[model samples]
Target: MNFAEKYLSIRKHTEQLCGPLQTEDYVVQPVADVSPPKWHLGHTTWFFETFILKPFSSNYQIYNEDYNFVFNSYYETVGNRVIRTDRGNLSRPSVSDIYQYRSYVDEAMVKFLSNEIKDDVNELLVLGFNHEQQHQELLLTDIKYILGNNPLFPVYSEFKSEILNLPSAAQKLLNIQAGVYEIGFNGDGFCFDNELNRHKVYLNDFAISSSLVSNHDFIEFIADGGYSNFNFWHAEGWDWVKSNHIKAPMYWHKIDGKWFNYTLQGLKPVNDEHSVTHISYYEAYAYASWKGMRLPTEFEWEIAAKHFNWGERWEWTESAYLPYPGFSKAPGAIGEYNGKFMVNQKVLRGASIATPEAHSRITYRNFFHPHLRWQYTGIRLAK
Candidate 1:
């Protein structure tokens, strides 16, 4: 994809997510987990302007020099930024005003990409695009969480998940003979800061489940006192269970007679065919242990993903999210993307239904604290 097309397409996807949102919905910032919609719009623009535009364009000028402080998300070396927690306080640049800022950025970015930018700018531009795509997903998830928390249980958009009957009878697990396999991105395309410095990784003989663990499978576990059974949980998992009193994954609310999961499109009857998301690594580990299975290491997941379209749902892996071998922090602010979270986080493979297709890829590694279930997280079994 050329510069304008790819950039504009990503911009459209971000805008589309906001299209269904109300003005009131844009400003609800509930803790660090959920960023205001206006923040996402401004922050993504900051990524491009700071990384690609200013460095590459000799004559580039920031739309608002003050915005560099307001929206510079964690780029320590780049300069001071607005304190993260106070993001909700910047109410002056209203959601509508932020949209105008995005448009202003679009004009400048298009002009830069169309002519004056050097060919070397292409790679960084792709990185900026992928970075924006990541924020787009975050925008949806954060918005959904914020809206769902409203007493009335407002939905940002329709949760239109179609339960498809995969040709179950025809589907069979494909055995990829174990060997040393190269994991991580080596392709000449856009990938995140995490999937870099590609190299070889060894794997043992292992079998991946034909599909992700389903909602039905999870329900059975819950029905069998999965949450109450201490034997099935790790010490940490048990502690988490008791501390939070988590009966089930977040969003799986038990109504009068049955369970319903809140989704982006809205609340829907839990579909058994869909991968059971919102599962934590703690719960996923317990479920795997109960079934005599394990979560695949990042290496195993990447090897298997070589043969699939990376699936519609991201599969949780046993791998703790970490930087690749010989990984070095990127100079300046861009370094914050992946280097910081190299510990105490697990890797997730594949992508979710809400994830943009352009952003999905095999080597993509998503990481979060083991306790976070708000993202579209699920499990794939290994043995």
Candidate 2:
């Protein structure tokens, strides 16, 4: 797909991913865990509108003047946003009106992009498309967190995922020989700044799980006292786990001696073979330790992942998330994308089934606070 087709297709697919939601669902922010659906909708648009549209289109007009205040997200370069906790409280553009606003912006963007947008901006445009795609994923995950809070436990969308099993269990560990390998996206095409300036790294011989740690494996971790036992956790991870009293992964509830999980299709029996997701770093680390394993370092993961399918599934690595060697942030508003996240985070590799096929790649650096699990974060074990 060329620039415009790729842009519209991805943008439209993002909208379709939202599925059916009642008016109230659009504004939900039950805990600090999630951004409201409306916020994501407007934020993605705000990206293209603010970065590409406003900068290039002389006649471009913002749909909502207050949006930059309400939906600026974390772009300090652009400006601070209204109090993040109160995003749901800004009821000015009722949910329906937000759709109208999106339509208006879409119309304006189509005209501006079709007529005057140049080939030189293709990279920036692709970056904007990917930025929106990331938010599109967050839109699903955030709403999943939000919907899970309701007593009704509503599904974010009606579509149920059909679990795909690997050809074999991939139960056995595969040992990767020590070698020097190039890790990070090659800039063969459009990629986030975080995955740039491809570099080389040396890896010792190591074994990584062929598949992600399954729910059944995690249950075994719990049965082995992985969470309750303090020895398996790090100092801060122990404190985090204790403070949260996290008995299991998020969306998992123990009832009448059975474990259940909330999904986009609603609460259902836990599928043990499906990769255990929505797990915090502490939990993942603890589980790894319990299995006589250590989390793969960032270099190890990126190096190893480059050998696998790019976007199939995101793998959790042992790396303490940080910037790569000789890494330099791209100048301008877009540079804010990955540089800000270099501190105090854990690295995750691989994409989820929920991830858009186009947006994921091996070098994509996904980081999160060690305790946050609302994203489609999952772990693969190694020793």
Candidate 3:
């Protein structure tokens, strides 16, 4: 597909994901981390209008002057925006209004793409495509969070079973030889700025698991008193466990004697064969420690990714989220994408089931605070 076609397709897919939701479902934000569905719809549209149409399309008319205040996320250079936690508090600019905003901006984007685009404009357009794709993944997971938290355990759709039944591979470890290995994005295709400055790093010999940690594997940890044992956890992790009373991974519920998980299809029995997901970095580390193994560093994951199956869940790595050598921020608001959140976050090295197609690569770096587990996060062992 050409530029305009790809743009339209991605935009349409975002809307399609919301097809199963009720109007009330679009406004609920159960937690501070999860944005309401309506906010995602409007914020993504605001991205295109703010970055591309306003700056490039001289003849384009602004949809609503106040939208920037309502939808702007964290771009300090883009002026004021609705505070993150208060997004759900606003009942104005209803869901229908956001859809209309998306339609209006999409029409403008299509018209702008019809002309021969300058190289810089084309670059920004690609970034806009990726920004929306990132939100698309967040949109699905956020929707899951909103519904999963409901006391009724509402089913979002009938598509949950298939995601849990990913093709399983024989569990084993692939050994890698110690040497200086090159890492980071080397391709000419689109990649986020954080993947730049491809460089070499010397690594000692190590072995990484070929398969992700399964639900059965984590259940064993729980049965062995993984959460109750302080030796298996970091000081902060153990503190987190006690403070939150976290026993199993998020969304896991223990009925009379059986374990069930909340999926998009609502609550269902925990499937032993499925990969364990929605785990925080702390839990991943504690589980690895309990097994006498460790999580692989991001560099180790990239070097060995080719030998194993990934993309099932966002595998937590041992590396912290930091810029690569020679990494620098771009000028203006666009530069605010990845550089600001470098500290106090763990890097996750693979894509999740909710990630959009063509949006992930071996070098793509995903980061989250150690305590956050709302995303499809899992664990892999290394030694």
**Which candidate comes out best when scored by lDDT?**
3
Q: lDDT by residue for model 2 over 1-383, one digit each (tens)?
A: 66567777877877787667777888878877578888888887788788878878887888877878776888888987877788878776677877787788778777776775676566778778878888887887887888887888977656657244445543667778998988777856777767766788888899876667778988998988888899999999999887877788888888799999998889999998787888888888888888889878777776666444334345566676777777788787777878877888888877777687667666777888888888877777777
Model 1 TM-score is 0.93
Q: Give the TM-score of candidate 2.
A: 0.94
Q: In candidate 3, what are the lDDT values of residues 179-282, reduced to their tens digit?
A: 99999999789999999999999999999999999899999999999999999999999999999999999999999989999998899999998889999999
Top TM-score model? 3
Please state the error at residue 186 of candidate 3 in Å: 0.5
TM-score of each: 0.93, 0.94, 0.99
Taken over the whole model, the C-alpha lDDT of each candidate is 0.80, 0.77, 0.94
Tens-digit lDDT track for model 1 on 310-378? 455667788888788888887756677789878998888888866866678778888878878778888
Q: Once all C-alphas are superposed, what RMSD does model 2 give against the true structure?
A: 2.0
How many Å off is the CA of 181 in candidate 2? 1.7
Clashes of each: 3, 8, 0
Score candidate 3 by lDDT: 0.94
Candidate 1 RMSD computed on C-alpha atoms after optimal superposition onto the true structure: 2.2
Q: How accurate is candidate 2 locally (lDDT)?
A: 0.77
List pairs with backbone clashes in candidate 1.
158-265, 159-265, 159-266
Candidate 2 wrongly placed segments (more than 4 Å): 306-313
